[model samples]
Target: MEIFLALLGFFSLGLIVWLLLKDYATPALAFISVSISVACILLILEQLGFGVGAA
Candidate 1:
């Protein structure tokens, strides 16, 4: 489950980068979109009791 979320985040980040490089998104929009995705991933992990410091 954690791996899935991690992969999802990775793919999302990749997509965002592609969009920016392709001129499909503004810098601010890309930044905000990535930030929101990261925040959502963290929240999901936290809700699942997966702390960043955990092994």
Candidate 2:
């Protein structure tokens, strides 16, 4: 499950880069996308027992 989330996060990061490079996303949109992706990655990490907050 951790590996899956890592892969998903990697893919999402790549997609965000691609969108920016391809001129498909505005700066605001890209920022929003990245923020959401980071949030999801953090959530997944939490679920996998590697979160920042106290248990």
Candidate 3:
């Protein structure tokens, strides 16, 4: 699930960057969107306790 979320975040970030460069739109929207995605990914990791070992 962590891998999935990471991939999704990466894809979203890439899309935002592409749009910003191709459409010449303000990067503010892209930055905000990417930030939200990153936050979500972090939240998911925390909820899953990914850092804790599965003894």
Compose the digit string of candidate 1's lDDT tens values, residues 1-55.
8776775677587566756664667777777766666666666566578948432
lDDT of 3 at 12: 73
User: For residues 1-55, could you state the per-residue lDDT of candidate 3 as single tens digits?
Assistant: 7666675677577666756664565678667666665665665555567633321
TM-score of each: 0.51, 0.57, 0.47
Q: Positional deviation of 29 in candidate 3, in angstroms?
A: 0.2
Per-residue lDDT tens digits for candidate 2, residues 3-47, read 766757775875667566547667787776666667667766767
Per-candidate local distance difference test: 0.66, 0.68, 0.61
Native-referenced Cα lDDT, model 3: 0.61
What lDDT, from 0 to 1, does candidate 1 have? 0.66
* Backbone Cα, N, C clashes tallied per candidate: 0, 0, 0
Model 1 regions lying over 4 Å from their true place: 1-22, 52-55
Q: Which ten residues in a row have the lowest lDDT in candidate 1?
A: 46-55
Lowest lDDT sum, 10 consecutive residues, model 2, at 14-23
In model 2, where do residues sit more than 4 Å from their true spots?
Answer: 1-22
